[model samples]
Target chain A: MPPTPRRGASAVLLPRLGSLVVLIAGWQAAAWFAGSRLLPGPAAVAAGIGEALVHGEMAMHLSATLARVAAAFALAMAFGTSLGYAMGRSDRFDRVADPWLVLLLNLPALVVIVLAYVWFGLTEAAAVGAVALNKIPNTVVVVREGARALDPGLDEVARAYRFGTWKRLRHVVLPQLGPYLAAAARSGLSLVWKIVLVVELLGRSNGVGFEIGTYFQLFDVRMILAYALAFVVIMLLVETLVLQPVERRAGRWRQRHA
Target chain B: MLELDIRRKEYRGVSSPLLAVRDLKLCLEAGRFGAVLGESGCGKSTALRILAGLDPDYEGEVRRPGEGRLGIVFQEPRLLPWRTVEQNVRLALPQPLEGRDLAPLFASLGLAEHRDRHPGELSLGLARRAALARAFAVEPDLLLLDEPFVSLDPATAGRLRGELADLVARSRATTLMVTHDEEEALALADTVFVLSPRPARLLGEVTLDRPRGARDAGWVAERRREIERLRAG
Candidate 1:
């Protein structure tokens, strides 16, 4: 109802840049008052990351964490999408499966990770399984909503024209589902990576999360910040480079038409 | 060739089971145009759906061409908005329409230039025509149009009707269209089957002996009066 000013790249960039500057300044001020060993500022953390990359084994830990995140993401998305679609399309299936879905969704991430380790006895499978189990419920809930919103009219058209399984899914079903899948992937990737960190910290011995846990025991905040920052940067890269492109491509039609 | 004999079709309702169609018999020989005429929500679409084989729960025996060669134009275009016009039509036939030229079909429907564009970019009339193109592209032995031109402006609907009439006549496909408009039924179909309200049964049949697209306003009015008199009796 009210006038909103026109926005360009600068409109978005300026506010975000301003906020980051303020955040960094506040962190630097806190580091100045606190001892550098306990509360390292941005420069010391950046130097710590450089030393780890050059002298220590940061890449191996980073790769391990990335691999775990990828595996858990793939597992969750594949299983969740199929389950969600089934639940969405059939009321009977949703009625039967909804309580389990609700229970899984509400179950704490920490509990799943701990139980998985307890049951599987501290292996790679347990770590990946725990992260996937935690992420699957969210993916199912999001994708089920996508499925429920599917166009029945198009479905009839597909049926009346006798679209074969492959052809119908590729052209009709998938195109309609693109946005939803993209949304699920974006959110699911973030959630899976976070849970992967928790899984790694709790069980695995060679990931960014494990490095952070080890540094925490020795009270080396600089190294802890270094590994966490490196991991966060890698995740940001994955989000921007991989997932954002997919989400953009998925929603390209709507933006172009709108 | 097509044949439909739906003894009864019912839908579950909140309070009671709602009857849709019963004792509705229809037959169309090869290269004929048939229409089911009824009031809005008078189980016309249910009958068409049964004929389309989308509604199999009905107690009926429907005989039509094999499923693969059937084409349907729903009330809405139902075009995948993400796909281009040409892709939508091309997808119906996995193998290309063997030795068939769709250039003329596209030209006749005025979709030639818009073939590479999405449905979202087109007007409703154009979208409907695109739907017609998709159906006709299959070179179907049987074509179904469910209230295809109902929601258009008179000019758009009229133009689309002419395009459809021309397309269907050229193809000589056994076409069955359902509509509430008697004018549309008379304009398109050779034999029109009038259906009664809920639990719709065939009330009567009016065979328009005149050739399609040749039955002008005057002839239509004359036949309409006769049909009205028949209904009154």
Candidate 2:
């Protein structure tokens, strides 16, 4: 191929146009072969999505699901970073926490969610807590390793200068751990959201996960596809608009520092 | 003055103690620069760690003056990868220094503009300079340096030595450095102590009465040969 399109023509516009063309072609073919009930043609699914939007059901569902994911992700970030930092800093802390981490990390997410629901009686707290608990162990493992890998020379220099705890954290610890934390956060968000969906499907009644289960029971394939499409689009939007920017900045830091 | 008395260190999985500095009593005078020169694994780095209060598990007693602080510069710049040059330098400073202290330190080390740049962005020379600034910023009573300029080009190392010597002279900080480089040991130190290999024992100490920054190439060269012979044996 001749050098791929440059700047204005190739970089921004072409890929999106190609994707649109492929999507439309796929939709028309599916609609023709599968008929509307088992697989709503693309146009029908789009119409169902519009209908869901106007009726406000999709918005309510999306907001509910998002609230659960956000709550769990926040909890994971706060607890994971602190616990990981502590474990990394002291061998005593590491020894005490290490076994518990292994236990939690190996346990199945479904088992925890089911147990949490049984214990807490299917409340929203149980749902969110399940997701948070599922994520913490994994995040802790990542952050701990990052912290452990810090250059001892940096710590010695910190001591020589007599840096206080807060200064050392800001200058030495945080920067060293930033990329690792970012990676943890990104991966955590993806995992926690999926886990939250499972939690909602099993125990909660108002989120996207609940809606998917509800539609599936009624054999409403169009509704199922609509909700699934909405989720995929939302995920793509978040990765592109949010997680990727942070990852890029951290990656640039790693390129220079590591 | 600071002193170390008969230090011994043993590592795991070794047949015997890895380093034994027998009767290693030495008093580094206040406001004087000294070098500990020996071959690799000669316990020189280990000695600097003891003086810096890093390795406290050893058997000997290390007595540093209580009034003045101690600053250490490692063989590596050891700047935190995630930190900017300014941040790395600031790591040792208790709090941000005001006017005279901050400005002079950065300018002296030629790191004024590169302050906001991270260690990843710096050249080997610049990183070492930042390390130098970090040491100076501590404003220590005693400065312990473990060949902090080992990776720099000759010109850069020479310039840094001059700047560091000047800084030590101005601050009147007692200094102890360990270096395998004979010329670096001769150029920067007022007193040089040579150590025997492995089970390190202090063989002899040479005192240089030359004024700071005044030693000519010939004088440094002559001392370098003597130290080289001492190390070679």
DockQ scores for all predicted structures:
0.70, 0.64
Q: Give the winner by lDDT.
A: 1
Clashing pairs for model 2 are A161-B92
Docking class of 1: medium
Q: After best superposition, candidate 1 residue B204: deviation in angstroms?
A: 1.3
Model 2 Cα interface RMS deviation (Å): 2.1
Each model's total of backbone clashes: 0, 1
**Clashing pairs in model 1?**
none
- Model 1 achieves a DockQ score of 0.70
What is candidate 2's lDDT per residue for A77-109, written digit by digit as tens?
A: 889999998998799999999999999999999
Residue-wise lDDT of candidate 1 within B1-233, one digit each (tens)? Answer: 68889998999899999999989998888788998888889998998888877877988798885442688888888898888898888877646564466788899999889988888888899999999998988888889889999889999999888888888878957999999998999998889888887878888888998988478889999878866765565
lDDT by residue (tens digit), candidate 2, B177-205:
88887777887788999988777778778
Q: Cα deviation of A99 in candidate 1 (Å)?
A: 2.4
Q: Give the TM-score of candidate 1.
A: 0.94
Least accurate 10 contiguous residues by lDDT in model 2 chain A: A1-10
